[model samples]
Target: MVREVLTVSERAPWWRAPAAVTAGALPCLAFPAPALWWFAYVALVPWILLLRSAPRGRRAALEGWLGGAGFVFAVHHWLLPSLHVFLFAVAALVGLLWIPWALLVRELLGGTPGPGRAAAALVLVPAGWLLSELARSWQGLGGPWGLLGASQWQVAPALRLASVGGVWLVGLLVVAVNCALVLLITAPAARSAALAGVTGCAVLTGAVWLWAPRPEPVGSLRVALVQPGLVPDSPDSPERRFDLGERLTGTLAGQRPDLVVWGESSVGADLAARPDLTRRLAELSARVGAPLLVNVDARGADRPGIRKSAVLVGPGGPTGERYDKMRLVPFGEYVPARALLGWATSVGKAAEENRVPGSAPVLMDLPGRPGVRLGPLVCFESAFPDMSRHLARGGAALLVDQSATSTFQDSWAPAQHASLSALRAAETGRPVVHATLTGISEVRGPSGGRIGPALSTAASTARVYEVPLARGTTLYVRFGDWPAGAALAALAVYCAAAGARAVRLRRPGPEPSAPPARTVRGSAGRRAR
Candidate 1:
């Protein structure tokens, strides 16, 4: 009797989908709150292992989609309170974006099942992931929030890589490391290749640590960040929020900071129209012996429109220096195709009147501090790298993000939002202050190190940091997104090569060996004839 060998699917286990979901959720631990950074390297191994067992492209695609759903759901789970039941539907739909990723992984890992395919997976898997990340980063889509590299915000060597090549390079290295780990278990036949890949990553990390340029400290600026800790559902009026901020900021008058920053929409009225309110802020600036940077969300008093603006107040009066927020949050600031998606407002926090965006990034002058310039990123603008890069290129000495995570403070949103400052700081080689309404306020140095303790969501207070400034630009600011561009070029080449190989394989091969005479003659009657 002969026994047939079972294919991977013939022995398919029941645990595959759950396994993918679990693997997908594991990486969240690598981010803030739990912040087990080392786990990020190995987090994807389980998914890759599942991919190895996937029988065909279709199966792999399903697994990939499921894993993607898990990741989106886990990372943005904090949105549940606001988004409610709709959050899961949104996550599952967004997970559809990973269908192509599954197909690619299967083609490289599951189809050929050899060293060549294994090697391709190591390079192409991460490339595919980065491309997916880049696509979702579009503002109309959800912006870049939980990027893979941002998990390494606290890692010194990774921050150096960001200084050299922006977050794209760091994310590339992280995915490469994950690929290497996957290879060790999933492709035992390619052990040599896996070892080499891991070694290359280690060597590259060491090189960055040993040689990356250190941020040189120029003069320091004492800046105070105030949090009002207001909740959205509370019965407190908008004016009450302002009063709380005013009270919190008033206490810091004794510290005598060079600048005072309040969270987004701290001033509900347009200061230009409300001269009385502007005067109050100017007096506060005078009392603190510094300029007060306050964010305003209101109908344009001078012009006939609505806007979200960052205004500077000096002892003399309004400094006339302002940065209107350039990038607006898609659903939060404005509903995309309002005629079509206007219904979004019924589901979540959509703007009553879509806030108008600024024309370009503005670098505002710091009153009384000659040669000191501040770049203000309002609310969601902090999530974008180009905004920060643009500000840095415009000769901004300090970068400040005025944010309000009041709605999602109880969720992962505040922690995730606050962590972005470190990446921005590293990329631009400038100090960054994340001032928020509720909490998770932070100050990061040029090298991405925290200047002081971050104010968590539980606090309603003000803290001052003697922020160290840097003189020259980092290579990242000089050459923007070069690493991502290179990765794109490489991906194109890889796809072309893979296409050619598939065509060759599909082409007709030589006929099989000539059949024996008996087989060719078929039956005995035919042979007799």
Candidate 2:
């Protein structure tokens, strides 16, 4: 009997590990701060090429894990001040989600694949990458902050694509382009196919731009944004912040603004607990001649724990409509699995106690406006596409995100947080108001076009924006994550096919038939004859 033996290769060079990490981190530049939006198209080329060159599946997976960790750390390095060394631990764990993706890349792009395999790589590789993103986007993991598609927030063409299929489609196309570029670089026989893939992406985007349903301009609203800028850190800082917001909002008198917005935690105490604060807010609303949408970061009066809420205060005071924050920041609002990872608080500024999450989304009706409705999302919740999509489906004419990134004022976090609103706006085909406590406040129209100059972190003032209101539902809002569903389906089909092939390879061949009896009887039969 003959048997085949598989050879195990030696370990990969030590330097390749760091190379993979560096390549993974390159995509961060395409995000905020540097915001080289065009860089996103080819940012994954080096990483893909490196993974493809891996000698073994295990090596490819290891490099994939390292690259994922690097990407996560690079994108979220701003949290170092709050998460400290614990951030590395998070990067490592969340990085595991990319292992399968890495293996898939290796299998598809390893060596110089033929035209057929190259075509498959363009489709399957991007699907694998999207699946990894979908997995890490869970609230317990990190949510979707640096999604590759998000880097294109400023691109009109990309924004048009987002309006049709949401960010998931944008990310898929971005990754597919990267894969095609990698193939063009390494696989000469497949260059034509790769070019076709790139062309296909462009054609799809252009088609959406030309044919996608656009939001119709219904009217315009005068919205005032109050940004208090930086308040000195002190024991009474919350009170000081509140006072600053109140003063800034008061300046809007006779502005005839339809709505006045304060940044996250603009009101330090719950209005239910502090009647004076409620009355003061109402007075400011009356003075401004508009309804006030202020965020409260305080212990809940009805609930037991701390709750961050967006409360609407009219001239009459405390409009019963309120939307508590549903999604909480992992370490910022509460540490995940505190019983097991409670020590995180000792290492960094992790939350001491978890804040209670809101039950569901709420759409508040605009004061005196019969049809207009406002959908409010708290700081971390703004990063979630589904949350905004849900609100848009619920008949929200405007999307508002109240955010505070004071801890990361000096880092890329503020800029990144602000950019997400543009994508959300484009996806939902509704104007988005991103009001922040410390800075980087911005507004985007339904097409994801900037409405006005963003308020810098250095500016402490109130600004009025003539925000255009739009009507009609975006295709993304109606279809609901179809891109993700398609990616998942593609991956499932690939996995099933791969599993069947592996089974076929491992299945034993038909057993060797016993030699004729003449073999055993040859000597004896000769003697007998």
Task: Please give each candidate's TM-score.
Answer: 0.90, 0.95
Tens-place lDDT per residue, model 1, 476-522, is 99999997788788789988987999999999999899867764556
Q: How displaced is residue 212 in candidate 1, in Å?
A: 2.1
User: For each predicted model, how many residue pairs clash, with residues at least 3 apart or on different chains?
Assistant: 0, 0
Each prediction's RMSD over C-alphas, in Å, is: 5.7, 3.5
Model 1 scores a C-alpha lDDT of 0.83
Pairs clashing within candidate 1: none
Evaluated with TM-score, which candidate comes out highest?
2
Model 2 misplaced regions, further than 4 Å: 1-10, 512-529
Choose the strongest candidate by lDDT: 2
Q: Which stretches of candidate 1 lie over 4 Å from their true place?
A: 1-15, 111-115, 231-236, 506-529
lDDT of 2 by residue, 1-529 (tens): 1111123223466688899889989999999999999999999999998999988787888889999999999999999988899999999998898899899999999988999999889989999999889999999998988998999999999999999888999999999999999999999999999999999998998899899999999998888899999987898999999998998888889879999999998888878889999889889888889999999999988679999999999999988989989899998898888999999999999999999999999999999788999999998888899999999999999999999988889999999999999999999999999999998999999999999899998889999999999999999999989999998898898889989999999999999999777545677788998
**Pairs in steric clash, model 2:** none
TM-score of model 1 relative to the true fold?
0.90
